[model samples]
Target chain A: MKLSDMQKDKCVRVKSLGVDAHFLNRITSIGITEGTTIRVVRNDRKMPVLVYVRQTLLALNREDCEKIEIEEVA
Target chain B: MNSIALLGQPNSGKSTVFNALTGARQHVGNWPGKTVEKKEGSFTYKGAKYTITDLPGSYGLTGNSDEEKITVDYIKAGHADLVCILVDASQLERSMYMLAEFAGMNVPSVLVLNMMDVAEDKGISVNAGELSRRLGIPVLPFTAADGKGYDRLRDLFETELSSPHLLTSAPNLAEAKSLKEQGEAKYTWITQMLEGVTTTGSLDYKMSRFDRLATAPVLGKFISIGVILLGFIVAMAICMPFMMLGSMFPVLMNEPIANALTAIHIHPWLVSIFSLLIPNTLYFSTAMAAFVLGVNLVFGYLEEKGFIARTAYQFDGVLSKVGLQGKAVAPILMGFGCTIGGTSGTRVMDNWGQKMLAMAIVWAVPCGSIWAVMPVISGMFFPWWGTLLVCVGILAYVFVLMWFVSLVFGKKLSPVETRTGMIMELPPYHKVHWGHIVKEAFYKAGDIFVRAFRTVIVISVIFWVLQYSASGSLEDSLLYKIGTFIEPVTKIFGLGWQSFMTFLSSAFAKEAVLGVLNAIFVGQSSLLDATFHAKTSGVEGMALAQIMSQTIAPAEALALIFACTFNIPCVMALSTTYRESHSLKWTARVAAFYVGSALLLACIVYHIASLFM
Candidate 1:
């Protein structure tokens, strides 16, 4: 399922990130490897989405999330 | 000793990383021929001493912007022993494009995947080993905020330092020849490396309907105006107590100090010296300085916490109403902190048209120093709404100025095709640390005090001499005479010699007008009191109002507005303009525009108001 389709505060694991190759590589270079768990903190439509990744909080826009593919783990 | 260059895009948390690595021991300098700040700090990590240079962040090294050129030149010239590129993990694809460019440079480099916490929370994964193997460099995942991976980074540095032979070969002629041919290969390698360790997932949630509603054209414009109104209201509400505290502090500190000094049976000259130098002007100045300093600290804290940015985003539509766009937003928002700082930030806009527009608009937004004086001016001179009217008038004036600027120098907005993207990293909401706040407060206070004690003090002493030498009174001194000579022109603004003199003294420093006023009316309690005291005693005691009443009408409020608007640029702002723009021509233009427009506006307002009143 698409990561943006999940409810706020829900934990999930990555299945695939659908982003462009260059963007995906950049994500992986930063330790956003497959099988990592992420939790949605705040989901503001049209604004950047806030997520908890590897113990740090990050805010990204819809354009960024659209590139990424995800699955529900919890 | 090995030198590492820290390079990244703006707002990539590079500075935070630099601060975390080398606290308080850094030398900040301007990049050659550019105003972009260059910071260098040294630290002994593990066994080796490393000097770290924090280059100004750029999206790519190919851009024509001064920052990009500086980064590209420094790296190509082999100034850095190791180049550490800090990439935003959240925006990896965009970042990788720049990474590929770096890979082509054939320089020894390391990749820092910052904001890993954010990346993990987004359910993105990376294979660090694979990326490192493909890139032929060590890749470290770091949450720079919490000191994670810093030790591993240090170890990597030490390892690289000990084995200097592992340095990447410089770009060879053959490789340069194959640049076009190998571009795709390099990209493919990066893609495969990314795919090896990364899994993508779909987002389970979509943007809410309300979020869409907020950005709708008509609704967004209204929301934008509402947001700005709220910011103004909050600023005014907060400033009330702030000003009260500021005004009361001088009285609280001055009287007791004066009384204690008075008790000492000393010569009249000694008393005069003590009273004049200690409890009267200088003491009040210090108190005001402290107050201004405190306000700056609070605002700076707000800025660092991203409150100001969020506020700007909320009101961005209203800002666009005045011809301000995304690039211009930051500087205008910063005007709330200090106009000098805001003016300096204009250099960040790469587009010449945008930079000029931002500069012109920044002057319209009053800084905190002006805001601090609002209540005093309103309560003493005019009605309760006076301050609000002045603020609204300034905003309106800015709107018109922006329109005029666009009409003259406006370029077609060609969809703004540039690498600059506004994906601001929002940190989790956290309580502000008082330690950081207080430290920032002291730094700002010290800077302002140093400037006053150095430059403003000289101007004050010169004015003191002029007032002392005049036979009639200090009010009739040479400085006042020159000011009075311009009284006829100023009369349209309803200003007499005293207010005119205040405007003249503002050339030295805008706040100096208040200082000059205090100097002229030290013993007198009020404008009315001063006038009465001056008339009863002698020519010397005649207050500025008494002088002004002879030349200009008392009912003309527009004259005062004109004087406020047309006066010389504040000394601090002048200095900031010179430094930031690095051109005497721009500085002169700013001064001429302010003074010329002010005089013209004052005359028009005076004539219009005279006909009405």
Candidate 2:
């Protein structure tokens, strides 16, 4: 599922980033690479998705968020 | 002196460390041609002199942004004897990505895990010895804010400078074709090196209570407005007392200085320059400096405490629709305080095209000086409700023109693909570091004051010359002759000679609009004399309003208001826009566009209002 579709407080791991090399470098440099655990801190509609990853809080607009593939962390 | 370069991502406390080391011995300048600031400072350690260059912060050495390219180029150019890479100890998992990206650089380096205090507060700890052992380089835990571990930092620097240690545990990725693959390799390398060497103790990965309100979906927008309003109000409060004191300068010293210069048998024009011209300009600069200082202080505090970033994130959705990113709102907010501040504030944007676009839009915002002139001028021409309507009309048109200009200039200035989606870190809230805030606020305020004073003073002298009259008759003055010569053209926009002169002089400084009107309509000898008389009599606003109302029609007043409000903000703002945008063609284009648009708006408003009058 797209990371933007994740509910608040849900933990997930990045499966793949469908973005190009430029954006892929940007996302992964911030520690959002594949297999990194992320918890949705705030995912309200019309707002940027706020996620907690590796002790840092990142806010990504929905368009960027929708390009990230994620898997439920069980 | 031996040289060192400090590198880190934004918010890694690199500046705090630089300031702590250099103290007052820092020199700030641009990096040759780029607007990117180059800060260099020096300190003596163990009887040895060392100079430090604080490289611009970047996410990595990926050469994506100018900042990143500058950092990588500087390192590759071998200007530094040692490279000090700083990472936030509190967020090493993310912050160390810089170090990961730096793996292949073959430069002698030391890793400073700064912000150790914050990490300790969260009950996280790292074994520096083990990490150092694993990475094959020196690592030190540091708290740059509290001045902790500086002695050790110095030792580490000294040791690294003497016998540089390149990374042995990490593979050099210079041969890597794609940055994505290099980033993946680096992260994998970072993960292996950090294994068993760090502990994140029960880290609570959640937004704080205040942050919840700050980022809440629809509600966050309202909260951001309240917060921004509150911040602006506080800035105004802090500035009012200083501005009031500044206003007293012209009243207190005008007569005495005029008498002294005249008594000294000085030329009347020379006397005017000293008595009337100097104090008036001083008063203006004082008000500008105090208010800009307040803006820097309050907004600096907001930015430091991390609230400003939240506002950017909250507003991204709305602002993006207007062909700007969330970060563009910062410059817009500063535009309400001062256009120079707003123009300079565009430095925060990473994209140069976006920076230029933001500067162009800042010109459309009714600046502080316009706000000061508009309400009183509007009140003179219309009733209370009508005055309020004009004020609201100006604001409504401000947004309309903003969208209109963005539509016209958006594609050429900022390409669609460059609207790179927002991917930013929302730093944790912390106490305001007063030392850093005050130092920065004063530096920015002082820089702007000097530039603004230069522009204001030069223009005031020219205005004095134009307003000079040996016969003391308005028509005999050069300003009147020239103004009337152009009156035929200006009247097309509903402005008489006096109003045309007012509109022209306003390009130098908006407050000068009133002085022009007073000089011509209120029977003052010159612009300088009018400013002095108005200051001493303390009835400038009320008196000028009454005089102008009788002489100028309500329709013309409405036209003048619209024209002046949208004119190029000031010469200072023009120069600042040029300096910030680094594009002479764009600056001239924007200036000419504003002038044309201002006249067009006036012509339109005047004709429409004339039908009713």
Name the best candidate (by TM-score).
Answer: 2
lDDT scores in order: 0.55, 0.79
lDDT of 1 at B538: 30
Name the Cα RMSD for model 2: 3.5
Docking class of 2: medium
Evaluating just chain A, the predictions reach TM-scores of 0.82, 0.94
Alpha-carbon interface RMSD for all candidates, in angstroms:
9.0, 2.1
Please give the distance, in angstroms, between residue B297's alpha carbon in candidate 1 and its true position after superposition.
Answer: 7.0
Per-residue CA lDDT of model 1 for B195-304, tens digit only, reads: 65665333344334643444444574455445434544444454456445545533565456557667886644344334443323343334334543544454545544
Cα lDDT over the full model 1: 0.55
- TM-score (chain A) of candidate 2? 0.94
- DockQ top scorer: 2
Off by over 4 Å in 2: B17-51, B147-159, B171-181, B200-204, B337-359, B383-385, B404-415, B531-555, B571-593, B607-613
